[model samples]
Target: MGQQAMDTFRSCIPLFQALSDTARQDIILLLAEHDRLTVNEITEFATLSRPAISHHLKILLENRLVEVEQKGLQRYYSLSLDPAVAQLKALIHTVETTCCKESF
Candidate 1:
């Protein structure tokens, strides 16, 4: 692979790794059902500590899987579909396009 392709693949690694964690996965599922939520609201559904929830949110934020909307003192977390989907689509497109073009 070229430098650009390698760079894109490297960038996507964290996203996949982030989803591999059960705690992070649960947070994503929770966000999917609701429009948005704050840490306090999320804590109501989870057994994790406030700091643990915050930590998972931080990873999800870093992976571009979720976004936060701050309203005054509250920060609402929501799933960010386009970015994660785009990255996945890019990876799929690369494999389908490049791999299929090759001869067996």
Candidate 2:
């Protein structure tokens, strides 16, 4: 990959940096299983303190990795199928296909 493409991919991974491993895993699992979540819900499910969840959410939001919607008094968060995710998936596909032609 070119430097710019690689840089973008590297930067995207840092959205999970503020999270503990378990917290990061929980977020991924939640996104896979649910359509959306509130901050309180994520904090409870992830077993992180509310402030920690909020910190991680900030990174996710700033990077456009997650979308936020305000409904009345609550803010809901959901995974965003943005260009970064698409590009990362495409890159993974290329690597897997080229490196493991028979299996992947």
Number of the top-ranking candidate, with lDDT as the measure: 1
Stretches of candidate 2 exceeding 4 Å from the true structure: 1-22, 89-104
lDDT of 2 at 58: 80
Question: lDDT (0-100) at residue 97 of candidate 1?
Answer: 58
lDDT of 2 by residue, 1-104 (tens): 55655655565465445333566557757976889999998877876788988877786676666788999999999987575467567667655655454774
Candidate that would win on TM-score: 1
What TM-score quantifies how close candidate 1 is to the native fold?
0.88
Model 1 residue-pair collision total = 0
For candidate 2, the C-alpha RMSD (Å) to the true structure equals 4.0
Clashes of each: 0, 0
lDDT of each: 0.90, 0.71
